[model samples]
Target: MNFGPPLTTRETPAQRAQGELILGFKRLGAVTKIDTLFQQGALKARLPRPQDPTLCEAVTLNISGGVAGGDALDTMVTLAPGAQLALASQAAERIYRTPGPAARIRTRLIVQEGARLDYLPQETILFDRFALDRELDIDLQGDAEFVGVETLLFGRQAMGEIVQSGSLRDRIRLRHDGRLVFQDATRLEGGIAAQLQRRTVADGARAVAGLIIAGPEAAHKLDSLRAVLNAAPGIVAGASAFDNMIFARLLAPDGASLRQCLISALEACRERRKLPRVWQG
Candidate 1:
């Protein structure tokens, strides 16, 4: 029972034998330009129905055949000074079961001075034997602000399966004015989930998401942020300021909870930074 309409289809069999879809967006001064680029696509995608669509917008990328190794989706988003943009996926990104290949998605975001970028995509779930490679890069000016949250689920819980198979190679990099600020390169393989839960990365949590907020006032709002996170239920989260950036982390059991926590955290930061409440439904 797929609750909604059949997850929007992409292309026909004859047309999809090529590669997957690729959606792209570029923003300049509050306006967005989209390019639905596909390797060999035939089906069309529709708009997402988000709980609070006004806060975020989604444009279909490429929808070709099923995901496979060497398949890639490249996107570039640029913001002008004094402009702001919020972006999210239409739905939880799904990685279908594949034999030996992996789906790859690369996203690059650029925030100019005095501009802001908020990217809150839904969770990414990997089915058994599924392989995926994801890369996210952010380039920021000293005064630019950026917020991005990504949640990864190991396996399909409903099927009573665990993430014992396949591999995920994930990378994250953030730079400010040509200086490296933060970088994380991690690989998850056999029995890695158990190790991740022991004491380090995520502590065995089924879902995890990170929020990065950078701007002028990020350093002054640490105390208030602590209080807000303390109020969330069944959540282990933290906030800190470094190199003119304020970042937060939240670990939970699933994607919905993480998104709620993200909304709360964003609201707290907005209040302290005197920015508008962009998550309001």
Candidate 2:
């Protein structure tokens, strides 16, 4: 019998994507305007109607919809002296399953003297086997106020998807007046679900959130924030006040509960401004 010709298989090359966005705002008279803007690849910025005349709002958009392996994004925001700006995302960022390399994200925020900046992006949803690495760096000058919030969902509980294995590395660094004021780093890999179930880890929580408020009045609001967290039911939350910064962390069994707890905590901290419209919808 004659043997058939040898068969061969061809492997497809991995697809890699990269994007960068740079935005700057300046104060002119009583209004803040975009003085510098740059966008490339899949990242873009959208200016929104400001509810406050002195505040400029910017919404970021990821045209690629979601991120997977070998994908990277970089964003930079600068606020001129005396300018005020609020930065948010158009929608929740999604991290898809990765075969190997982890998706990466880097964000840098610079606030000048007497300026104010609020970074309030929506939640980040991670799928099974997804891998992501993210870093946020904030620099503030004299008397600059900065507030930021971050939320993470391990998997879509509504869809019955649970994250059993994956990798996540997140870091946040803040410097005020050339001195480091805050630093937080978290890493989870391999059996994510099992790790989250550990009492010392997440205590079986599916969702987690963190908030940072750094300014003159941060210390004064600690007691109020603690009270709010104590009153919230079905959520594990706590807050601490440092020299000039206040930090809060929350954990819940589901995303909805986590979001409600976060909102309540923010309200207690005197963040009365309405969240971005995208967050509400």
Candidate 3:
């Protein structure tokens, strides 16, 4: 083996996108409002006119358009006692193809006592030759509540795009009252299209989603959530609860079907509450 000069192209600081965003909210009288917010680089947060004073709504935007290898984004959200917040992305995030290095995304969510939070970012579409690694960590203090979802798609099947080769590593961890309640991790590499078609995998599904509801009363709604998942058409979904946490997974034949099922399931998780405006339109 020779340790000569390496010859591999990589994204430079000027060519790669780097972003960091932090948002904090607290309850003031009857309304939960933004306490502190910080954004840098290609990430931004926009607050729409509040329809419900008790729940503050926010939408996140990616200024650099989409994601590519060597790109990095860091996001953190915190809620103080008695505060409520609903957060969503402006639209679906697409991961474009990269040369070698994989793009990275990290998110941290903190909910203090008596606070409630909904983190409902839209789906992520992965194109061919893409590489992505993402992680989400949620820390819930005493009696804090959290509802979140993540959706992933292999490619735009309608556009004749197929994920013939790619790599994705996704992980989520939830801790309630300082104790770990739920965790899920997925790793896929090489010939993903063929891999997803296996009988035990997705059964030819083109899209997939994961939803989690965590709170003191979360487990009680498992039955209803399961019912909603079962009734939805064009998707195969299931739900399970452990302690105060409820977890569900859905697989669909296309993005449109996934969105419909997801919207219904989200409404059920939110107890008939309306989703963020960005999701509706």
Candidate 4:
């Protein structure tokens, strides 16, 4: 008599994965080890043998393939006093079109007194209609050094795909000894292609990259870094130094040209430090 529902079946809701990765490095005399590593959901981190005995390297991988709508990723890296570390991604990150909610990514870097960190991940490729919101927050203590780069591509040029409409919001914040030193934010929506073509914007460039270096030597190396950027081929690049930091902006016709310019700039900035081995291939 009470069978009004008639055995109705309820569809299961799709589960959107939320992933996080945390890595910590500490120095014992001249050697560094991955003192702490925690991974959950679809994110994983690996520590490989460093070519330099005093440096530690960590590579992050996204096992879920790529990010989609309703997905979230949070990453944190910490370096102990006097430690040296380099963090890179296994490959280029791909952002797929989101039908509803925008994908979110947050990265935080902490460098202790006298420590050094290199955050050099590969480019992030955005597919047509994709939506993404990303933020990078850096905290540095006394005499700590940081070198980081962020590269973005509108779409896969080699695949004959171009992004016409999409949404992207990116922010970068840096603090030294609990005092904010640098902050940058960018927002794009609707017809991103048309916006990027504006003279005041990318000026028809399909790829853009930013490199930031902060340390005691940043100001001293500004001229050399500017020279390297100026010598880059087929790329529009500029370098400036202020507030104990050296910043460079690059715009290129495609990702390949941008990568070349970035490699040269990184070498100049790091001095004796070499690019991450993953970048060679």
Whole-model Cα lDDT per candidate?
Answer: 0.65, 0.89, 0.92, 0.90
1 versus 2: better TM-score goes to: 2
For all predictions, the C-alpha RMSD in Å is 9.4, 1.9, 4.7, 2.4
lDDT at position 178, candidate 4:
97
Estimated TM-score for each candidate: 0.74, 0.94, 0.94, 0.95
Worst 10 residues of 4 by lDDT: 1-10
State the lDDT at 226 in candidate 3.
89
Cα RMSD of predicted structure 4: 2.4
lDDT of 2 by residue, 163-280 (tens): 9999999999999988998899999989999999999889999999989988877888888888877887788988888968988888889998888877777656636876666666
Writing each residue's lDDT as its tens digit, candidate 3 over 98-213 gives 87699999999999999999999999999998999999999999999899999998898889889888999999999877788788999989889998999788999989999999
Query: Residue 153: error of model 3 in Å?
Result: 1.2
lDDT of 4 by residue, 44-114 (tens): 99887887888888899999899887789999999999999988999999999977888999999999999
Residue-by-residue lDDT tens digits, candidate 1, 1-281: 45776668775532112333344434443454443434334223343443332222444334543455556666666666655556655455666656655777777787788766777666677776777788989898869877777777766565665665677888989999989898867687756457557657778777677777767777777777778788888888887788877777778766556667767776777653322232343
Candidate 4: the clashing residue pairs are none
| Clash count (model 1, backbone only) | 8
| Candidates 3 and 4 compared by TM-score, better number | 4
Lowest summed lDDT across 10 adjacent residues in model 2 is found at 266-275
Best by lDDT: 3
Better of 3 and 4 by lDDT: 3
Off by over 4 Å in 2: 1-9
Clash total of candidate 2: 0
